[model samples]
Target: MKHITFYLDFISPYAYLAFEKLPAALEGVSHSVTYQPILFAGLLKHHGQLGPAEIPGKREWTYRQVLWQAHEHGIPMQMPSAHPFNPLALLRLAIACGPNRFVCETIFRHAWRGGADAADAARVQALQQQLAPGRDPASDDVKNALKQATNDAIARGLFGVPTFAVDDKLFWGFDALSMLRAYLLGDAWFATTWDAATRPTSALVRPARG
Candidate 1:
């Protein structure tokens, strides 16, 4: 069985998109998925993504084009206005939910599919109310939990969400997940004959001394 750790943020449209279809993609495969919530914008900055506005016009246009692709997958998404940079609160709530599958799945679906402004105080609280009865997403306990999760995330060298880790390999981006599934299945034949345990033949060959 392969273990997959899914690190993601609610603010990421691609991450939201991945959540909908990734489970089905892994169906019948021996796998387990764990949620690890991290700060998306901070990670992007570290990866040299100078925010959306700084993107080259051509690249930005191409990105906007991908939004249309969301519809093909039956995902509801758009560049929400006033998207907040702070995902720490949401991350905290996910972490608090821990291995509670129902809780995590519910929040993810609502935030992504329902267009919930997760960072908004009232909206986030309302979501909590719906999901957990008396549990408040805006409560002091939730706030403290989020703070602790953010601290932990930073200490772990995490930079982004929807970051999937299979074994020792870390795959970022929704597009890269295809490669991740291939790895999990021990099937490199589709793209190449290389085995995960063995490096490509070229990389393994030693140079003759001149």
Candidate 2:
């Protein structure tokens, strides 16, 4: 059976949005999804990249864009009280649940839709117990598993959450879902290269400051 690897982090609203829509988007397509929880903060640090929320203008635009995308997708979304909240416990819990999709979705909703503080260890443990009774989020195995997953993601050239990998091709961002779907459907355009000479220049290039 064919499968796609979904690398995600609960701290990302975009990841939550992607989790909500991907199943339906791929309906009727014969492919399975493997959810891999990773430390998004680790990825950012490894790549020396600033998240959208770290930038002034981009932060505001990202919040607006996320809400717009959620509305368009008819999904409920509420920003958590904190941005870049610690997701160590959450990631460990997800791994404890054996990387289950339902568990992942529940946690994603708790943070993004329910506006819950996923950084709280106690709260995260409670949620994990609810989904996987008797599972220990603090277990060494679970902790190591999450770390390994993050390392594996970094090794695969993933610097963002909600990244979908089908075979060797990797698609990042929730907005890339359409392209992924088209590729899954065997679209030939994806394999064709565009002629740079025929490309038109942008009409809105900003002038350099004096």
Candidate 3:
């Protein structure tokens, strides 16, 4: 059996797609999954990296690819009215609701199912009322929990959203989902090719930025 921690942020379209595709991806395998909401921006800041949407050319390419992937998998998705909107409220709400996939799903759909502004205040209120009626996402506890979740992800060596952690091995991005399933299936190549891929030391260094 495989146990996985699905690290995500609602700002990531790939993460949304992964969440939708994951159940079928692991259908025949015996596994348990925990969905964790974290701030993707915190990960970016810690790693000194810019998000795909932050780069103009890459942003367009990402949207193209995400749309194609969603279509290919037959997952229902609509490009949000904006890209890279604030996801703090949604993240805290997911954590505030306790251990429920429905909360996460509702929030994901709110962002990706309709062609709407992902950060609209009215929609946010609706989500709070519908998904976690009594929970206060703005409370200090929920805010701290999100901070801890991001910190914990950093401690575990994660630098991106839609990552799957299984048995201490991290598979990153929507593209790596198949690789994760293969690992869970006990592929022999992971013992050889996988470890070998990570063992080669860097032989060259790029000059530091000013």
Candidate 4:
């Protein structure tokens, strides 16, 4: 069986989208998925990039597009009371709660299913009661796990959430889910075009801003 490591942060709506659709995308395929809750902010800092919601027009577009995708794919989604709020607590909570499919799903739904503040005190308490129970999300072990997971992801060259890592290949974005499934199905192109596309060298580099 193929092993796939799914890297995610609950702040990403696309990650929630990918999570909902992954099982169907892998229909008739034999594979095991491991969910790793990493800090999205850590990735952004490591990669020297801004999160989607931090960009200009892209912020609004990202929301609009994901909602459109949800409608098209029949996935239930609603805008949270906020976007790009701190996801550290949620990430640590996911780890503290065991980081399994059920844990991750419950957390994602809490953030994505209702049009309310995912980080609101009441909402977070509800999640803790239901999913984590008596587990301490702020405990040292859970906190370290999240940090280590994010470091490992950065080392793997992952710059974003909703990433699927199959062996050495990294597929980023919910839009790339189809590509990931194609790889899982043993598509010949992955052995051909996929390698060829990355085999070229850049003729020129853009000058760095002074």
Backbone clashes counted, model 4: 0
Candidate 3 structure quality by residue, lDDT tens digits, 1-210 = 789999999999999999998988888988989999999999999988899999999999999999999999999999999988999888888888873677788989999998899889999988888875456889998899999999999999999999999987999998897898899999999988976887888999989688
Write candidate 4's Cα lDDT for 10-81 as tens digits: 999999999999999889888999999999999888877788899999999999999999999999999998
| lDDT score, candidate 3, position 49 | 88
In candidate 1, position 67 carries an lDDT of 74
TM of each candidate vs. truth: 0.71, 0.87, 0.96, 0.95
- Which scores better on lDDT, 2 or 3? 3
Clashing pairs in 2: none
Give me the displacement of residue 25 in model 3, in angstroms: 0.6
Cα lDDT computed for each candidate against the true fold: 0.64, 0.84, 0.90, 0.90
Ranking by lDDT: 3, 4, 2, 1
Candidate 4: residue pairs that collide: none
**TM-score-sorted candidate list, best first:** 3, 4, 2, 1
Model 1 clashes, total count: 3
For residue 120, give model 4's deviation from the true position in Å. 0.9
Clash number for every model? 3, 0, 0, 0
